[model samples]
Target: MESNEPLYVIPERYRKIENLHIVFWLLKDLCWVMLWRPLGLVMIVPTIGAAALITWQTRHIKSELLHNIAVFFWIIANAYWMITEFFTTDDSLRYYAVIPFSIGIVAIAYYYIGLRFAIKK
Candidate 1:
């Protein structure tokens, strides 16, 4: 990663919007890991919304498409987990959800690393 580069280059006009996308990205993770346990189902609303905004902002960057896809999948997994919490009385099921959930985080990490290299180009 470029030490000076905090973000991938975007048109000056879209810089703020792009930054919002990053905030939403982090917020989605925050909402899931922390907020969902306390606030319950409402967390998915912003989680999906952030993922949508992220996809929209990064759509033109071909290198990010896969990363975005991984993110969406991860978000879906989280949504599934949240929904299960409501409908299932089984506590052990969440243990199983950890597999996909962990994969999503790994995918997001790959996206970040890929973005760093993509910007280097």
Candidate 2:
């Protein structure tokens, strides 16, 4: 059977959904970076290390569910640090909060790009 057809046609609904997803992801990243950048640089090492560990583990586990679980914990840790910093007026609390927030940013990126793509596939 030989068929002649339109080469490129996207359904309106799918296009809208995809566009919304892209916008949401971008907004999420922007918020995280804006809110966390100061702390992010300070904790870069651990953030990178955690991400590397997640990437290596995902290869062996091959489970989206597990990856999602890791991502959840990463987000929580980050949020906790942020909350702690916001509530505490003490100067000493500043340094301790950076690690969690930085790692959280890395985890957010990983999930937004990697895990989300994997699940879609």
Candidate 3:
């Protein structure tokens, strides 16, 4: 049995960008893990750019928009945490990552607690 709900398919171009986004995200994390500071710093631009682009592209879809926005924040938090580690051995500054992390969480929470209900109604 199939319910009557339209399927959501990302445009091929969008999907391509999304795939590339994954590559950039992974490369950024890899560079961070390997302690390649320069490359990791460079990777942030493309990684965050792709995330922002995805969020913009999905703005019309509330769920996708919220999730993509969360992804954007998640990358920011990750990059910031990476930078903190790269710059200092101490974890003192790592707490700053909480800001972006919380933003990401709020975005998801809003989607689940607010937008999800609004959409169903």
Candidate 4:
């Protein structure tokens, strides 16, 4: 039996940007791991920019919007934690990264707990 649900396809441009975002994210992390502060800090611009762009592009789709928003927050939290490690010896400040991390979690939770039920209605 054939299912009736429509296929969802991402545009090629969006897909290309998403692939590039991964490269930026990896470079950012690699820089952090190597203790290369300048490059790591620079990489934050493009990495966060790409994530913001992706979230904007997906805004029309509730599910994608929620998840991408979470991703945006996740990248911010990761970058902030990396910066803390790069600049300071105080490990406690790194805990502040939890703010963005928690936002991401709330976005996901809202989707799963709130939006999911709303969609079913």
Report the candidate with higher TM-score, 2 versus 4.
4
Rank all candidate structures by their lDDT, best first, as comma-separated numbers. Answer: 4, 3, 1, 2
Candidate 2 residue 74 C-alpha distance from true site, Å: 0.5
What tens-digit string does per-residue lDDT give for candidate 3 at 22-54? Answer: 999999999999989999999999999999999
Best by lDDT: 4
Between the candidate structures 3 and 4, which one is better when assessed by TM-score?
4
Tell me how far the alpha carbon of residue 93 in candidate 4 is from the true structure, in angstroms, after superposition. 0.3
Report the lDDT tens digits of candidate 1 across residue range 99-120: 7667766777666786667877
Model 1: lDDT to the true structure: 0.66
**lDDT (C-alpha) at residue 96 in model 3:** 92
Candidate 4, overall lDDT? 0.98
Q: Model 4, 1-121: lDDT tens per residue?
A: 7879998999999999999999999999999999999999999999999999999999999999999999999999999999999999999999999999999999999999998898899
What is the lDDT of every predicted structure here?
0.66, 0.52, 0.95, 0.98
In candidate 4, which residue ranges exceed 4 Å CA deviation?
Answer: 1-3
Q: TM-scores across all candidates?
A: 0.50, 0.31, 0.92, 0.95
- Considering TM-score, which of the candidate structures 1 and 3 is the better prediction for this target? 3
Candidate with best TM-score: 4
Residue 72, candidate 1: alpha-carbon lDDT = 68
**Residue 89, candidate 4: C-alpha displacement in angstroms:** 0.4
Pairs of colliding residues, candidate 1: none
**Alpha-carbon runs more than 4 Å astray in model 3:** 1-5
Candidate 1, residue 78: the lDDT equals: 68
Quote the lDDT for 84 in model 3. Answer: 93
Q: What residue runs in model 2 are displaced by over 4 Å at the alpha carbon?
A: 1-62, 90-121
